[model samples]
Target chain A: MEKRVLMKGNEAIAEAAIRAGCRYYFGYPITPQTEIMHYMAKRMVEVGGTVIQAESELAAINMVYGAAAAGARAMTSSSSPGISLKQEGFSYIAGAELPAVVANIVRAGPGLGGILPSQGDYFQATKGGGHGDYRNIVLAPASVQELYEMTIEAFNLADRYRMLALILGDGALGQMMEPVVFRDKEPIDLPKKPWAVTGTGGVRPHNTITSIYIKADVLEAFNRKLQAKYAEVSRREVRAECLNCEDADILMVAFGTCSRIGRGIIPIAAAQGVRVGLIRPITLWPFPSDVIARAAAQPSVKAVLTIELSCGQMVEDVRLAVDGMKPIAFLGRSGGNLPTQKEILQKIMKMVGR
Target chain B: MQAVFKRTAGLLNIPTHYCPGCTHGILHRLIAEAMCELDILHRTIGVSSVGCTYNNYEYFACDMVQAAHGRAPAVATGIKRVHPSKSVFTYQGDGDLAAIGTAEIIHAAARGEKISVFFANNAIYGMTSGQMAPTTLIGQVTTTSPFGRDPDAQGHPINVSEMMATLPGAVYVERVSLHDYRHIIQAKKAVRKAFRVQEAGLGFSLVEVLSTCPTNWGMDPPKSMDWVAEVMIQQYPLGLFRDPKLEESK
Candidate 1:
């Protein structure tokens, strides 16, 4: 039997990252994300790793860039305002083609709105958060166990694709506690980064890591290459969990903690004489749009309802995915407010005319 | 016949984009000579910051990483933390280090990151065509300070070495120049000492080189060199601001 340990979502992700061979962590203090930094400071030292409580988020992300460029599995985590500072580094990392992981333990904010949980960064996560024609591999984990697993996978996916992978979580997911089991992962044989700045040893020609391409034509070519890689990721990595999606009167779409709310609405709506189903997205970047299209295409699914912890962010994706196959309804509560399972059920029942 | 001096392989023998008589070329050679002398080129990682030398990564024969403006020191700290045995350094400019990247450099020094920082202080933002700089002399005129820098309005020029000397983590802080043949030789020696301080893991080491931007300064090559000696040095004095070895001897 595997040993079970109770840990906060942030700690679980931190421990999983260490298990995934992330030896360097740079972070700044932010509520709901500080536990990850604390865990890394203590545990990283024990495992012969390094963790720095950086001076600022801007400094932290740049440090991650340097470590990643030097061929280390590096990571950083922060809440909203701090993630804003990281945008500059993310753009450079994407342009230079380095691999790294970052987690945004989101708090309420347009500008330091509050420290409570919020999922207002969906567009920022799915679209480019930084100034560029690039996107990060964004993962949305609804449970602590899933958060742990995805944190480990984020490293592998980042290196495999040679880009950034963002684990987008809210303050609630970061603070909540759950029993997590530590599973020994099979050794992964990732390809060595021959392009990294691991000193030339005087034998090999020195490698240069940079994001600046002065010529317009050269930069365009590099951008095209990034687009092709993103296309491949979309084709290969779209993941969603569908529950009773077929033969339902209504289908609901959601992600992260709200997706769990989307699932609970099932039983409540069923008891109220209306059949409802759900599609919980795992990879928010390579969004499971096709899954939504399929579920909404079912003859019995009359309408699609999208629920969120923000004022209709993922609803935009659902609208894009459903593509007029079914009429869509959006129900959201922004500014640190979460709609209850029963409240979501009422929205679903209203769609089904119950 | 025995070869007395040949170019060092620490820097590649490639043409640079620097203007004629620009002091960046001289500073680059001094750093290359130090790398060759210390036998650390193969294991050294250089971080090139933004400015005219943003692309210096291409000239350095050792592995190089080009960092964003003002973030080179933080980046170097990250590299050194991971590869403590390998040597790491950041080459930055007045605007990049003293102005935009002020926080990063200050924190890196405060933490005593085991890395070397080679600062080139030319008193103006040459790449941007002579904008004001944090280390600009009080009366110097640049595009931003058209009527000459007024101490009351623009604030006093920052003495980088003197400020660095106050930090305990900064084990070696020296202000050098390339105004003439004698000063050029002394500047090379200071560069070597900066690298040696890092080699000995003696915390953060910085060597601020008083460089020239002749084109932006609107001066002829020789006049620019003379200006550095006769004018620039008055505000940024040439001397060692901090050295643990000197302290130990005392």
Candidate 2:
């Protein structure tokens, strides 16, 4: 019988990645996310895997790019500024169509804002943080246990799509500790990469892994192919949770730490004679748009309030999903300020004419 | 009748996009020959940096990965760490290495990564049409330095080989030239030795080849060769800066 082991959220991610067969980890130290690197540094050695405290985030991501190009499961972790530094490499990895995983334990930022949790990077993660026509599978896990499961699933998704996968959690989730049961399970599906850059050994034609297409037409065709892949992902890979969404007049849309607070609000609002439902997005990219659309389509749902740790980012996606079907409101704080349950409950009270 | 000359199997039988009179073709040939001679062609994975040879992946008869500008060293380090038994190398130019990628190259050597680097120093940015490079000599004129490079204004050129040799992890550092037949032969030897150092797991190795860019240098192909010998060689000297075997002897 397997037993539950108490682990930090960051440690769960590190340990889970190792179990998922990630042999290469390159990271540079950054706030809140530093523990991920520390854990990997200690454990990777025991597993005979390669882990390096790179000189900078740029090098770390490029290292992931190289290892992925060579057909090895590779990942890197960093916070806000560090993730910004890695954007160039991320673009290259995406353009080259290499499979890689990156964890952004997001901290407050427009620039060096604070080491506290903030969901300010929602736009950056869901949209293009790097300069290019590309997207990463952004997995937003709410708890330590979810962190472990999603990290393992992230590797498989990255390989299946030949795209980058991002574990987009904020500082609060990164630091929180809880009991995590590391499951003994096999991969969902690990596909063979025939186009990896491992040496041909004179048996096959040499494989060239690159993103450069000097001709305009060739590049357009490649972009079309990538768009088709993303379209398939949108149709098949969306994940979200809808709780008490039926027979409800008010719906709260949130994710990550905000979603945890949202769950608490459901009970508090219940005592106040208010009916509220919540939809928490698990996949930020290829976003759970259809689920959101379905929840908003419920005639009993009168208003949708999008709460977050940012001024507003994912609210835009929420608006698009709702599509003027109901009145939408955004309530939140930005720059390391997290919304409390009391604040959100009060906002809901005003919205429901309490 | 036996053929007097033939191309190395290490390079593909295809045309290259390099400008006429550019020595990139020569440097590519020397490195390809070394890969063939060392019998490591099958297991060699090359990192192509952003420059003239960014697409050289198409020319080398081995696996290749193109890296972001100045990030090739870091990329190559990742590849080498994963497949310790496989041969890995990066081909980078002056702007890619000495300027933008200075940090990566320095740290890769400092960490004693067992990978080979083929550095091309043409004293100008060839891909972007002749900008002033980090290895551009004082008083040397290019598109960016139309009046001539001034030490007080643009700073002095970097002697990358000498700087790299200072790092203990850089076990083999050599600066060679492809200005003439004799020096081309010597440069070939240096390229081979760089790979041999990585194969021996000695540490990092680099071969800085002083090459010419005729179109960007505003000279004929023959004059470009002469300029490398007379002008470029003065700033970036050709010599072995570090040798693992020599250190062992000492």
Candidate 3:
């Protein structure tokens, strides 16, 4: 039986990481996500894990990179600006195929955007925020329970694929308190990382982890191999949830907190005779394109509406997923303001000619 | 004297890709010889930095990781923390270390990360074909500094070892030159000491080796060495700046 407790989303992620065997954490303080660091700092020491308050976002991400290269399950948390500073390290880690978890409790941003809740970084999160041809396994958590669940899965996916895994949340998700069940009380037995730099006791040769390849041909080959791994991930790892889409006329697409809002409006819209259905993407990067296409193919489905807290970032992905089978519309609110149920309801009403 | 100059055991026996008279050959030999003497050949992990020697993992018999340019120190810090028993070191060049990776090295040393950094300061960016480096001396000309390195406009040369020694985290810091036989011998000693400090469980250690780049300096091999000795040494002195062993002795 899983132990159930009332916790904030940020706290659940911190506790779930401990349960998932993350022994090292490096992060700088950032709004809406600072509680995760604070919780880990207190709890990791009790569990004999290491938690460091890094000097800067760059230092924190590099520290995570270091620990990941050493084959330790390490993580960092930040908002938009801090995450931008971490892109260089993230790119390097992805290029090197090092496993690590990054929690982005996203806030609105072009620059120093706001501390309020917003889903403005959909493109940056799913399409690779860093330089180079690489992708992170991006997990979108809608609630506190999902936060706990997704963070643990993020570690597992990162380790299995040897790539960066991201938990993409917003300020609302980070700040919201809800009940969560903690799974696996027993110490997790992580897979033996043979590639890690665990000291050579004269029993084995030394190991080094880096991304620099001088020969252009060799570097190109390395890139191709990484691409192959990504392709494999895409085939095997698409995750999403369809709520009442079977007989629905309008399919509403959203993720993270926006999905929760969209879910809330589903019954209300149904009562108003809108017949709107909701499709929530659990994994944003290995997007559920197949599911979206299937939803779009429905003859009764009028249009695909994508709702987010940004100026239409995920709409492009929704458009790509629908592939012109139906019209795609976007309703966005930016600069830390989350869309209200009424606003989303109005958008759906207007779209369906109600 | 029947071929006393044989390849080290842990080094590949293939011909090096370095240009004729490149100091990388000398530096590689010095590190390999130190590893052999210390009996840590099997337990060493070399983190190769971005530069001409980026693919140095191919040469070293031990396990190797190629770090992003300037991020070797951070990578080494990670490897050392996870496997404290392993001998972890980063081989970095001037551009990779002094310019791009300045924050990483400084923070690693400041945090007292238990790793070693072998800095190859050739004054110019050799791998990029003679661009001006952070350590490029005043009035020295390179591809980017065609009109001579204007000290007034472009900052003065950075003395990395001196800067690092000021940090409380560094347990060993030294600057050595490979411009001559005497300096080369001293340079080897400095490299050995840096490794020993790490082996003894001391904090961050660094050895900045003043080397010659004949191709980038646009001089013959011998003249490059002479230029390094005469001009480079005057700007960047060579000596041990910090040693935890000496502190304990005092």
> Which one wins on DockQ?
2
**What is every candidate's C-alpha DockQ against the true complex, given to 2 decimals?**
0.83, 0.84, 0.50
Q: Residue A175's C-alpha lDDT in candidate 2? A: 96
Best candidate (score: lDDT) = 2
Interface RMSD of each: 0.6, 0.7, 2.5
Interface RMSD of 1: 0.6
Which portions of model 1 show Cα errors greater than 4 Å?
A188-190, B1-5, B246-250
TM-score of each: 0.97, 0.98, 0.95
Instruction: Kindly report which residue stretches of model 3 are placed more than 4 angstroms away from their true locations once superposed.
Output: A185-187, A199-208, A213-220, B1-3, B246-250
Residue pairs with clashing backbones, model 2: none
Q: Model 2: share of native contacts present? A: 0.78
Runs of candidate 2 exceeding 4 Å displacement: A187-190, B246-250
Please give, for residues B1-250, the per-residue lDDT of candidate 2 as tens digits: 9998899998999999999989899999988999998899999999999989989999999899999999999999888888889999999999999999999999999999999999999999999999999999898899999999998899999999999999999999999999999999999989988888888889999999999999898999999999998888888888989988832221
Best by TM-score: 2
lDDT of 2 by residue, A95-202 (tens): 999999999999998988999999999988889889989988999999999999999989989998999999999999999999998884865345788898778888
- Positional deviation of residue A158's Cα in model 3 after best superposition, in angstroms: 1.0
Model 3 has an lDDT value of 0.87
lDDT of 3 by residue, A1-354 (tens): 666799988899999999898988888899989999999989998999887777678878877887887779999999988999889888989977899999999987889988998888888898888898999999999999999989999999999999999999999999989988776646677988888765455676656676766689999999999999999999999999999898788899999988988999989998999888899999998999999999889998999999988999989989988989899989888988878999888888888887
lDDT of 1 by residue, B1-250 (tens): 9999887898898899999999999999999889988899999999999999999999989999999999999899888887888899999999999998999999999999999999999999989899999988888889999999999999988989999999999999999999999999999988988888888888999999999999989899999999998999998999999986832221
